[model samples]
Structures are given as C-alpha cells and as structure tokens.
Target chain A: MSHDLDWIAADWGSTRLRLWAMAADGTRLAERSSQPERAPRTPAEFETILRALAGDWLERTGTIVACGMLGAREGWVEVPYRPVPCAVTPAALTRAPVAAADTRPTLSLHVVSGLSQATPPDVMRGEETQIAGFLAKNDGWDGVICLPGTHTKWAHVSAGEVVSFQTFMTGELFALLSEQSVLRHGVAEAGWDADAFADALSDTISRPEKLAGKLFALRGGHLLDDLDPATARARLSGLLIGAELAAAKPYWLGQNMALIGSDTVAHPYAEGLAAQGVTVLRADADDMTLAGLRAAHAQLAGA
Target chain B: MSHDLDWIAADWGSTRLRLWAMAADGTRLAERSSQPERAPRTPAEFETILRALAGDWLERTGTIVACGMLGAREGWVEVPYRPVPCAVTPAALTRAPVAAADTRPTLSLHVVSGLSQATPPDVMRGEETQIAGFLAKNDGWDGVICLPGTHTKWAHVSAGEVVSFQTFMTGELFALLSEQSVLRHGVAEAGWDADAFADALSDTISRPEKLAGKLFALRGGHLLDDLDPATARARLSGLLIGAELAAAKPYWLGQNMALIGSDTVAHPYAEGLAAQGVTVLRADADDMTLAGLRAAHAQLAGA
Candidate 1:
C-alpha cells in the first residue's frame, strides 16, 4: 500500500489472523487484523482470509513470513515440525499452495515450522517463532524461555538451540475448571483475589499431589461455606499454575529464565517463579511474535 | 402394586430416578426406573417423575425413603447437611413437601441429609448413602470406602460414622480430558490398553505433578508416533486416576479399603490400589445404595 512497504509478517492462529506491514528497513509501517465469524474450513479459505486482512499490503511482489497454527496439519499447509535439539528457525520455510487467482505470483507466502520434542513427546506451533524472536534479541542467552498462554511452554535453550521443551495445559485447565467443571458453580468469570491466589499456589506447589483432590472444595466451599466466587476463581488459577511450576522446576531452577508474555497471562508465571527465588526477564508477547516473524522474513529476503 | 410392597426405596439423581418397591420383610418386591428427557425443574416435577416411575407402587399409605441429588437445594428440597464426626443417619429425616394430591397423606417422603466436612470444606449428596450401606454390612469397619464415579469419594469410615473424606475430580477429569480437551483428537471412546494404563498410573503416582505436562503428549504421541487411540484413552484414564490415588494415599495406605461400583468404573481404582499393595474389598454400588436406604427405612418403621 505504501512505497516503503517491503514484506508482510503474519501470525495466523486458529481463530484470528494478524498482519504487520513492514518497511525494507524492518520497521512496522502499518498493521491490520481479522477475526472471521467462523474458522477457515479449507486451505484456499486461508488464502482468502489472509488477502482480506492484508490486501493493499499485498500490492508488491514481496514475501510473507507467517507462524502459528497456519503451519498445523489442518492449516493452509502442513509444515514439518523441526525437532528440538536444533535451531529455533528452520533452514527452510514451507511455501503455501498458491491459488489460481493469485494476482502477484512472486508475492510468495512462507510459514515457519513448529518445534517438537521426542523423548517426552511435545509440540508447539505459534510459540516457536516467539522463542526464536526472544533468542534473536538476546543473542547467546542460554537459559529457559517461557511462553505462557493457553498451552504454556518451557524451553531449555543453550548454544542458541532449543535443547528440549515441555508444554503444560495450565491455562487451558484453568479455563475448563473455572468455566466447565463443577468449580464453575463457584468461580467468577473475571475477578481478582490476590491473597487467595498466592496461598493456593504455595499450598499446591509444596504438596502437588493434592491438586486433584482440592478441586472439588471450590464447589463445596461455595455450597457449604458460601466461599467468595472471586477467591474461588483465583484459587482455581493458582492450583493449575502451581502444578505446572512444580513440574517445570527442573527447567527454571538455578537457570536464567525469560518469560515472553504481557501482564495478562505472564504475571502469574513471573510471580510464581519469583516466589521460588528466580527473577524472570520479560518481553511483550505481541512484540515477540512480530519479532519472530521479522526474523523469519529476513531469512527469506536474504535468500 | 403387590400386597407385599410395604415401603419404597428411591435413589433420585440428576438424570435418572430409581425406585425399589419393598416388602415389610425388607425384600425388594419390584423395581422401576426413568431417565427423564430433561432434568426435573420444579419440586412438583420431581414428585411427578417419581409417580410416573412408581405410580402403581404408590397405592398404599406407606413411606418413600430416598437419597441423592433429590436432597440437593435444587432438588425436591434442601436437606441440611449433617456435619462430619456424626452418625451416618440422623435420628430424624427431612420430609419432602406434600403436594395437593389427596391420595395418601400417610404415604410420606423422607429424604436423607448429606454429610459435610468443615476443615477442607467437603460435602457429599448421594455417596453418603453408599458409605452408610457399606458400614452397615461391615459393622465397626474402620477403614476407607472408595466410591468411584463422576466425582469419586474417598471417605474415612470409623465408629459407624464418616470421620473425614475427600472428593476428587478424577473420573470427571478423565471424561473432560479424553472427550473435550485437545487429547480428544487422539483418544478413543471405548477402547482398552491395559499396559498403557498401568505404566501411566505408575509414572504419575510417583510424580503426580507431571500430570499437566504429560497430557499434551497424548496428542503429540498420536500425531508424531502413530500412538494408538485406545492406548491414548487408557493413558488419559490412568493419569487422572493416578494423580487421585497419590493424593488419596493417606486414605488407603495401610487401611482396609472397600471399592463400591461395577467393573466399568471401579476396576481402575481397584487396580490402582492393588498396585500400591492394598487389597480392595469390592461391593456392587446398587446394592450398597439399597442397603443404606433400607437401614434408614428400618429406623422409620421401628419409630
């Protein structure tokens, strides 16, 4: 759309598509987004959805580097997972299948491959890019990189390669327990109870086995003692996150850790880690996603 | 109704109603059941449901003794919970409101009071009856009763009373994780993999906190390793139940444990306990429910 527009950086997830119009100098010129009423059902529909989001920005014959679920099996194209004990960004990018209506054939589309771990069996889609971006910024940073969201990830990074990583369903568990489980009767949708969170976190972390047994108390506390919904909500969050921290202890203990997320989802992880005497370096999640995409796009532009 | 039908035994839960027509000699003369298209909404609707299920059995001026969600606040009437450190059955039962129907004023409805604990704040609706029934059969039994279901209960039964208990979302978590979570993509509905269940159970029981981390492996293993769906299903069940067993170690360790339920649901719990070297005494859940209701009815009749 502009004379300075060089390429596009995209982060395509299951529910939304985000595009960043980038200048030749790597500065973000403009940005656009679209949350379709329904998820794109066909591979061709993904292209249609992307075009609608970044039509004007697609005027030039430039490359688009994307990450996230767009590389998933059901996405526009299936990108082979670059197994861990390897570089964050793959040596090659998977090209999206071009549709017949392509006005600019040279306007190529490339997706970054997700990372997978073999021994314990784990995989991540959009997160691999963020890890790459964080590593790009802090070159030679050898420690754990945590990307917290629906499926929170912890990676052991060293020698500029992800040695190994693990994924935890902490955030998803909090959602299901607070909204879908019997705890739904006691937990409020959006509420804060800081003390309750801290206590529950400490309680579960020290005695992690009690996690499953303690869940029903949320509903019982409400029914029998009229426990506050807000407190119950915070406790539910603490219980799940605390369990994750207990399991991820090996990843963060005595290791420099960088948490890539904003206050919304990352604060708790930061606090949880801090409680264990580990100071967490933090980065904004959006910046990291774009940075990762920019890093991948730079490779394509260089090639 | 048969002339021998003296009193009725009912276990009215959320989705279904079960009625046992009983003779004066404590024999179950006949039985009937109904799974309503919809859960009963009004108090009158519950009575209407019972009538439809046992209309002929309502011929005489006798009593209807019941337990379960029919005693929940949203059920027929709110039965005040008898706090723990007390008898399984209170001296008096709460009577359901008599509707305007004039057929049998003497045919009263007596609902059992659920039990509650204050320290951890736990409550039980229907499981208390099963515990009571098990206690009646093995008088002076001083161990634990494991009732595995949607919300599995592990109760400490001593001195003919429930001293303490804990409720785990293990069964419910298995249903949600295997049927609703991302693991749903890889798990089978009705398949069996015994070894997978055993190994997962052993792994998690030793390190219960790893649960949140290991769930994604179910999906990843399927995608990357062609892990069988049946094994995935069994692994999911084992993981949740293992975590519960670890949390409930104090309840079953070095204690006589009786598992109440048919093989469909109770087998895993029994096996898990057996793995821990605890020989589990087994009982049919339905029989236990009737025995508890009969114990209560015996009190009413003698009174």
Candidate 2:
C-alpha cells in the first residue's frame, strides 16, 4: 500500500509553532503543535517530541520543510537565511544538514529567513510567510498591506515579493494602554467613533509632529471633567491609529493599499480610512497564513 | 497666657480632609488631616471626627475661622454656595448660615463656593483658593497659572478671579498610560527624553486632532522596530503635554504665564514649553495654598 504523504510544513515562531503533515497534493493529513524548539531542546529531545507527536507520520513521510523560526539562526539547526531579495521558493528554503542518530529515519529539513529593517533595526520572524501567502493568493497586486498584531507589519508588496515594510507595536500598545494605563479608568465600552477616529487621523495627516502630546489629552479630556470613559478609550484608539497612519504614510502614499488581518485589527483602520474616503481591501489573516504555509509545502513536495 | 488663635484653614476635597489651626497673624500652629467626610458621614459623625481632632484646640482658642470642604452642602453644616459674579471675600463666605448644629463653639467655619465653567460643564474644588493664593502672592498678575495634580488645572487668572480655565488630566493620564497600557513594557524605566517629549508635544500641537491615535504608535515604534523605551515613554509624555499646550492655547495667548506647583509636576511642562519660548513663573504650591487658605479663614473668622 502506498502512503499518500510527502513533505511536511511547520510554521514555528517565537511564541507559537504549528506543523502540518501534508500529502504530495498539499492535502493536510494531520497537524500538531509543540513548544518551539529553539535553543533549549536537544536534537534527541526534538526527535522524541516530533516522533511522539507525528512520529508515525514522519516514519511514513520522507522530508519535512519548516518555515519561520525553525530556520532561524537560533533554530534546532543553523540553516542560513536566504536573505532579503530572495524568492519564497524551494531554493530559498534550502535545507541545512543535521547530524542525527543512525536509527533516525531520513528527513529533509529546510528553514526560511526572516526580514529586517535598517536604521533603527527592526525585524520579524514568522510574518514573512504570511506576507508571502498573502501575495501568493492575491497575485500581482501592488500597494500597502497592513498586518496588525503585537508587532504590526506595514508592507509594500509588488511584483509578487514584499518590497519593503515597517512594523508598528500597535497591538502591544493597545494591550498596555487599555489594561495598564490610567486611561483605562476613563475608557468607554467597545464601539467605534468614526468621527473621533477620523478627526484623529486628520490630525495625524495635518500635524504629524503633534503625535506625542495628543496622547495626554485622552486623560485630560476625561479627568479634568466628567468624561465618558468609553469615549476616552476610543480616543486612545484613535491616537494610536493616527500615529500608525503617520508612520506608515511614507509607504502608504500613491499606492493601492489593502489592510489584511482580523476584524479586531482591521476594522478600526477601515472605519478611520473610510471616513477619509480611502478605499481599503480586507483579507482574512488565518487564511493567508495557512495558504502561504500550504504553498511553501507544495513547492517543497515538488522539489 | 492665652492664645488668640484667629483663623481655621482647611483643604477639603474628594479624598482628603485637612484642617489647619492658624493664628490671627496667619501663623500655622497645628494641622490635622483625615479622609474627607463628604456624604457618607452624618453630621454627628463628621463633627465628632472634626472635634475629636481639633475640639480641644478650638476651646483653648477664641473664634476659629475655617475654609475648605467643611462649608460645602455635604459638610457637617451646609454652607450655601454663592453663585458666580460673587467675590471670594469673608462676607461672601459668611453670608451663608452654617447648618444648625448643637452648641455653636464660637468657631466660624467658612466654605468657599466651587467655580463652574459655563462653556463646558466643569467645576473646581478647593483649587480656586489655591489660584487665589497664587494671584494674591503675585500681587494681581494677569497670565496663566497651572496647578498640576490628580486633575491638573490651567487657570487664566486676572482681576482677582479665575477669568477662565481648563483642566487637563495630565497627572491621571501619566499614571494610566504608564501603568495600564502595553506601553508599560517599554516604559518600565522612568527617564525623560526631552527630544522625544518635544517631538510628541510638537506632534500634538501640529496635529491637535491626532490626539487619539498617537499613543498606539508608542508600541508600534518600540515593538515593531528598535525604539528606545525611554524615548517612547518621553514620546508619550510629549503627546500629552503637546495636547495640553493645544488645549491651553486660548489661555496662553503667547503671554508669559506662571506655573504654581512643585517641580515634580511643573518641570515637564516647563521643559516642554521652554522650547516654544513660553516664559514660566514658578511658585511654591504649599505656600500659595496656605496663603489662600489663611486669607479665606481670616474673612470667615471676623464674620
């Protein structure tokens, strides 16, 4: 009997690691996740864990191609990054040789390279695949695409490759501001104030420099007098979004741009932008990441 | 030897209740503070707490003049608030009869009426007296005076009355933004970034509307890229201060203003405003509040 299994795909990042057992035709047979094996996990430990989780499948399968953190410098094995200006192809996800015990079954391992920014020196681990996935699915669309998360990505994608991008800590800031800041006391219930947000966006576009001081006004508006806490919180949202709009302006200008992410992340921008009469394209986050992972695995199976 | 203690000065507000035993000469002899007995405490309970703290002193001294929350409607004796266009004189304070109590202990408790803003529904607690003290000490100056605290106040003082003022929750915002927000991660350490703060302030002033979105950029700047947390924190500060400056533009009018408070609160604004060439007058907060309290008490004592 022939096993329909082929290459495996793993999306290992700093915090999450997901692996899929794919067939030669990109059919996912089984999937599993474990703590990312960065520096602490020994080869034996990884082998044991992988075997226990997908050992039966690995035994039946021949090669595994893992993208994301697994291919990082600090991954289980040192697979040199394909570096920027490289395509998200099988050639770029080239494998690094691993020394395993004689009892170990033969499996090919490949890692993907992360991207970095110059100047202030910013980088991302697993998001590149998501971007690639987004591009792969949308084929030949050029403009700015925002992937909002803890470390948000504002990418300029054209010609099927991410040309350049910037990361903003929007999600992290929201978490901190809502949960930790005194502004929490004044935040209103979750609801969008298109007018407030638009006002803030216009503020950013007009007075890019005012980004800093405007933050305190959130508290000032609510505290100096009786202010609706929900409005205050919304104002905070407006402020952060406004700042992102300002920082992302350089890349956002004169280009067709679409915001891709969850509703939680994209809706606010959509609301704010819609008020400004800017058309924004919405894309599903999970689908793009999964699709990208699937595409990477397909290329490896073909190789 | 008999002590001719002339007046009583009190600093009453939401959380704290402070009463000072001052001589006719305005020499403070002893001071007492407790949780403000606003509404929760009955007249008996309120008077008991007050008498227990200062009953003996009042007996030893002649008539005692008092100020602060003790004269509010919620006080042990309700003091009717003299509406706007009324002076902060001893007559205005004494015009309203104290609520009927047991034996009047020859102590005259005068309450200062809170100031209300017509344009925006807002009011000030005992800070008006503090503003009065600042004005009295400066010998009738016409300019802006900022009292920074839980609810920071920027008062336009001229002709002995607070002409018009706006309060900004600068202190509250600082507390909330620093502790509750994801910005907390980057702002764990407290250090001032003059440039970052100035930039934020400029950002706010330039784009007053961006007030809502500026804060999210903190996390974006810090997490997505390598931004100095210190600078990020300063940026937050700058955003708030900048917003305040924008709000205070009407009051400032490019005129020289005095900052009435300690360096702890005024220093940041002073530094931020210096760049804009706004001249600041620094005065002692304690001395000014005490002076105003004394003045109010003296008026009530004679009445």
lDDT of 1 by residue, A76-132 (tens): 889999888898853347887666664554447898998888888888898888888
Q: Pick the candidate with the highest DockQ.
A: 1
DockQ of 1: 0.79
Cα lDDT listed for each candidate: 0.85, 0.65
Residue B242, model 2, lDDT: 84
Residue-wise C-alpha lDDT for candidate 2, range A117-168, written one tens digit per residue: 4433345566777777777777777788877777677777666665666666
- Leading candidate by lDDT: 1
CA deviation > 4 Å runs, candidate 1: A1-3, A59-62, A89-91, A101-107, B1-3, B59-62, B89-92, B101-107
Per-residue alpha-carbon lDDT of model 1 for B1-303, expressed as tens digits?
Answer: 345778899998767789998887788878898899988888888877877777777776458999999889788888999889788853336787756666454458898889899989998888888887887788878889999998999899888878999999887788787777777889999888989999999989999998888898887898799899999999988998899989998998899889999789999888888889999899999999998998888888778
